[model samples]
Target: MTPSISVVIPVFRSRTLLPHLYDRLASVLDGTNAGWELILVDDASNDGTFEAMLALHEKDHRVRVVRFARNMGQHHATLHGIKRSKGDYVLTLDDDLQNPPEEIPAFLAKVDEGYDLVIGKITGDKAHSLSRNIASRTVQFLVGKILGKPKSLSLSSYRCMSRRAAEAMGSYSGAHVYMPALMLGSVPADRICNIPVAHHPRLEGHSQYTPRKLLKLFSYLLVNHSSIPLRFMTIWGTLISVASLGYAGFVLVDVLANGSAVTGWPTLVILISFMSGTILMSMGILGEYIGRLISENARSGQSPVFEEYP
Candidate 1:
């Protein structure tokens, strides 16, 4: 039987919080008149998180578990569960219980209202570090500008997406799996909506989102999702080419009119260095894009499953 909703949670060393998260999700989901299932995806957290997930599956057959062969980050783990979801609506949330499972209904409410994607907007005080908060803001701004998302809507890990929205993400096979960027691209701006949800402090351990991970995600977003970097290089390259031509023309006019060139040889050397650096930078950008393309086309598997329990 198909469930009305499928809850996809990415687990990473959150063994202690699993019991509470499962209980709350079950409790809230049971109240609604909809069939639901829970997908617990372990992002290769070798710290025995899969054991807890298996226990939950034993307790309730509605629970599904998948352990990756290696760590693929939270977004990759989530896309795996979402692909396995057999529900009308695919809901995602943090395993730390920061975004309460109780907020599931609010997201569902918007989904029921025909919204393709319903994201949770953190209301009141957010329980995160300044850097994490800044990263989140930076992601939202970039998504808005690059993906043409509405400024009014916000992005969060806690959200509900319709089956169509989930299916639309099938084209993204690259390693750069930015969930929000893919989602915003899949659904139209008008179809995406946001509802306020309360955010709480962590229940057990620190966030899996470290500074390095955040920067990596940002880098992938810039390179994989948008062509702005290439465009910037192209524009600057053309301008620099024009500037070099103007300088060459100046040297020509000076040699013809007076004696040698213009003034100091340092100016010509500086101009050469500047243009060479820009050319090198542009080549590097093109190489990165080409490398990613090769990686994308030659892809063998995605989120390879090590173990999955019934």
Candidate 2:
């Protein structure tokens, strides 16, 4: 029988917290009195995470587990998990205890109100460090602006979507997987809504998101999800051309008024340097876009799932 809901979580080096997370999910899910399944996608967290997932499966048959042969990143893990789910509704949550499983009902409530996709916006102060918080906000702001999402709608991994939306998002194929981008692009904006949810401190370990990962995520959004780069390059190149023309007229005036363009070498060199820098910058931006295009088209194999619990 198809479960009423499926909870998909991507785990990475988080074995220690799995038991606690599972217990909370099991308790809350039981309270709902709805048939549900927990799908845990271990993203090659070879640090005994698979063993823990298997332990959960042994404890409860409703706990499904799949471990990647190699690290495929969190979003890829989630996409796979959701695809494998057989549920009328799907919830994606972090493995960390920070995203309380208790909040699941709030998301369900919103989804029941005709919302196809309901995101859990963190209420009050977040428990992340200042830098991480800033990075999160920056990414959220960029997503909202680029995706043309409403200011009231915040993006979070702790979100719930209808089975129809989940299947629609499965149509997405890319080398880089940004969940928020995929969610926004796949679902209609009008059907999406956000509700306040409590965010608690981590029980153990720390955030796996390093600065490098955050920057890569930001780059993914900018290059893969937005045409702003090409548009920016166009406007930037046009302005540079106009500047060059203006500089040429200045040099012409200097030559005609002062006999020769000998003293114009300094400004000429400056202009050349500026133009060179702009050209290189534009080329770099174009290269990123082309790289993503080639990547998505040329992208082939992925790390296989070697283990799944019954």
Candidate 3:
């Protein structure tokens, strides 16, 4: 049977949540017009997760398993599954059950309304920690500004993409995966829709992401997807230059008007420090962009080696 929908779930030590997730997914997608296949990418889990997935595959032919050679991050695992999927639409979600499988139909419905992508938006109380929430919101704001999308739209892994969108996204190769931003770059805003979905507390295992990882991901997006950081650096450098000129004029006037030598070493030290710091900061921003370009070109020139399962 040809599957109309391909559901990709990235698994990292998520053995405990499989049973309930499978049950809910089966119930919700059983009678829908769209035929479905679930692709689970095991990110080199050492907790017998691969064995469990093999068992599940034996029990149900619709469930397919792909094992990574190493613990590539969640986004890499997702890309792996996307490459293997044959369905017309692809949906990616977490294995921890934070995103309910019941909402899959709603996402599909939105996608059917001619939208290239439909993202799930969490409404009501958020179950994440305050710091996590803040970090996520900050990412959302920066992503929207950089991508020129509406700030109100939230990007989650629990989203559905049309076949065209999936194909467009499959061409992207990067260590960092901000799917929403990537998709926004390829597809227009009007073609994207946001559907409200209920958020739930995690039923098992701790979140794999930390605040530091969040910041790192944001930095990657800023460096890779947009030049806003460089623009800000340019503006900052101009402002500092203006301020320095103003201060130098003030010092000259003071010296000339009072007929006294300016003898404060501290003021000279502060001015030099500020100016040097600004110059170094601007160079650092430029360095980041140049480094990213170099790395991307290197990766593009190299041939990726893939291992096939027996």
The local lDDT score (0 to 100) that residue 8 gets in candidate 1 is 92
Clashing pairs in model 1?
none
Give Cα-based local distance difference scores for all models.
0.81, 0.83, 0.78
- Measured on C-alpha atoms, candidate 2 has an lDDT of 0.83
The candidate, 1 or 3, that scores higher on lDDT is 1
> For residues 203-254, could you state the per-residue lDDT of candidate 1 as single tens digits?
8789988888898888777776666676676667666666766676676666
Clashes of each: 0, 0, 0
Provide C-alpha RMSD values for all models, in order.
Answer: 6.3, 6.4, 6.2
Q: Provide the lDDT at 115 for model 2.
A: 88
TM-score of each: 0.84, 0.84, 0.80
The segments of candidate 2 whose C-alpha lies over 4 angstroms from its true place after superposition are 261-310
Better of 1 and 2 by lDDT: 2
Q: Itemize residue pairs with steric clashes in candidate 2.
A: none
